[model samples]
Target: MPTFTALTTLVGKDSAEKLGEAMERLTPEPTGVGVFEIEDGSGLWEVGGYFTESPDAAGLAVLAAAFDAKPFVVSELPETDWVAKVKRELAPVKAGRFFVYGSHDADKVPVGSEPLLIEAAMAFGTGHHGTTLGCLKALDRIAGEGFHGRSVADIGCGTAVLAMGAARIWPETVLASDIDEVAVEVAEANVSANGLTGQVRCVEAAGFGHPDLAAKAPFDLVFANILKAPLVDLAPEMGANIQAGGFAILSGILNEQADEVVAAYDAAGFDVHTREEIGEWTTLTLCHR
Candidate 1:
């Protein structure tokens, strides 16, 4: 059996979402359809569909034309054990004192390293992508600068890698939240797996809305590894939640989009502390003024 993906990028969120909904109605219906904003400051949204069978090209063409999007680039995916493949391809990533790896590489954890276990699973933030790894590195850098977190939060904490990282290094209760309930569940699972059940509390919330997050406001550090639009949207709320002189580690931004995110935070009373680029992604460390 082969999997197929049909992907395209369009100008607006509404149209891209409409195209994603339309993709679900194809004759050989897609198993899943997703709409995501491109984080390159391009103001474009990408709509994609995954199919167990080959998609209807003409049907895709109709949807693209209706949405005024570029034609879908459909590709057949080969059958393979993706988990095993990921385990083979993704070696352990080390950021300062933190070592992130899966259980498959349990034996490889180096001596004297603060280990954070993030298995290759359905959720994001596995520490393999530049975004997650960069966040870990930023956190490591801040810690190296003699910063000790009294309070911390990880917004959009997929797999709670950042939360667990903070928990491992600092003596603080880290609140980890995600808009998706499933991601929160995965985060909790990861927390428990890493023996951080009491240190890292997982919740489902959009940004800083939930009571658990709000109650723990004026945090010393915050980690948000989501996309550019959300990062920009989160600035004011993030400023409200972080204490004066607090730190923020942000990623999931393309190299070209770093300036846009930085400007948004600057307007919200934060100043750039550090910037790191890993591959096409950029991670920013900012201090609340």
Candidate 2:
């Protein structure tokens, strides 16, 4: 079956959400609709719809004009096996002491390296992306400094790879949380696949909203590989939740935006311990004062 997508961008979140709701009433009716804020410091929200049949161009144009959104760009996506493609394209990634690989490369685990198995189908945080890679390396560096995480949390953990990474070395159980329930499920699945069921706990929450995460406050180490805006917003809470002299491994920041994130954390009483750039992404290791 062929799939089609119609995408447009608008200035405000309200308008984007309205446009997404309107798309659900279209003739062919979108199979799914999504509204997301573009996180590049641009005050833009993107509205997109997916359909099994071709969308009605006229209806899309009318909605775009009504919402003051840019014209919808409709495109037909080729039917490709995305999982197979990921398996072929995503090779094993080695970050310091951690070696992340899929089952297909299970035989390639190196001696003396922490092995973290993340299937390609699970997608996020397979240790291939610069942000995740950088975080793993940062964790390795902290461990090398003789810092052991007694209590840890992986906020916005995608596949719980970072949590698993922490669990691999430390005896403490790591808590992994995500706002999306699906991501929590994926994280749990990955934890089991890595033989880390009891070592890593998965929960659904934004930031530290969940009870498990709240009760386990003042963590010794925290990993948040989310974007700049959220990272900035999370600083104050991060300050309160992390123990004095604890560590925070933060990523999902562009190289250009690293300064802003550092400034935010600095205000929260965190000193920049180390900053690393891999490709266009920057990872920060901070110490709570």
Candidate 3:
């Protein structure tokens, strides 16, 4: 398959964050599709955000039409290809079990003993994004403390990386949900691929407090790696769903946005547990009051 490049920028720093937040809504849905063709163990490939699947010739046009992006398809010299390009691009990220590449790296988790391999595609959760890594670290902290019989609710679970991490390290019961069906599908695939279907179940939910979630009230741990505004809006609901003394992990906030987000949690009855930062993003862990 031919490779493509989408080099678009948000209007400014603030706009960048807003754009990133908006793009998140498109994830876990078929908003984009990518195909990687490997030849001679390497080929030209691209990791672009797409809103729909169409003929290769039409992919760029579709992207241009659906979103404000500069989408252009590109190929390499006859011998050199996209896979090699991605490999080179991803090489620097090989520090841990997870390596995140590209601009959308905030949506995945790349931790734990077993390797979490996710191609940089239109899907979320490639272990490189700040939101994903921050949540991973928070999950690791919880797991390290030993989650014996705790119950976890992964809100806005995207690719279910947090759910899988909880299952891998803590053996806790996990319920992972995403607003996007495509995200749920990808999460299911990853969970199954990692042999975690029994511990983690992926489902679709518009947001917290959905009837189904209410049915599973009082989670020992609640994790949501969504943006700042939504986190604020869901604070009350999150506080209600978490059991007293349970842990709550919140992400998807830029470092500068951390305090405001944390205050929302505090006002909703969650006590500050710990806060960590990765690059421009921050992760806050709290205890439900």
Residue range 1-289, candidate 1, lDDT tens digits: 8999999999988888888888888989899999997756578999999999889999999888988999999999889998888888888888889998899989999999999888876325777789988999999899998999989999999889999999998878999999998888889999999999889999899999899988888898999999888999999998898999999999989998899999999999999999999999999999999
Local accuracy of candidate 2 as per-residue lDDT tens digits, 58-172: 9999999999999999999999999999999999999999999999999999999999999989767988899999999999999999999999999999899999999999989
Decoy 2 TM-score against native:
0.98
**Most accurate candidate by lDDT:** 2
Query: CA lDDT of each candidate?
Result: 0.91, 0.95, 0.66
161: Cα error in model 3, Å = 0.8
Off by over 4 Å in 3: 1-84, 91-115, 120-123, 146-149, 209-212
By the lDDT metric, which is better: model 1 or model 3? 1
Worst 10 residues of 3 by lDDT: 37-46
Q: What is the TM-score of candidate 1?
A: 0.94
lDDT of 1 at 159: 86
Which whole-number lDDT from 0 to 100 does residue 185 have in model 1?
A: 86
lDDT of 1 at 161: 92
Best by TM-score: 2
- lDDT (0-100) at residue 72 of candidate 2? 98
- C-alpha TM-score for every candidate: 0.94, 0.98, 0.65
lDDT (Cα, 0-100) at 285 in candidate 2: 98
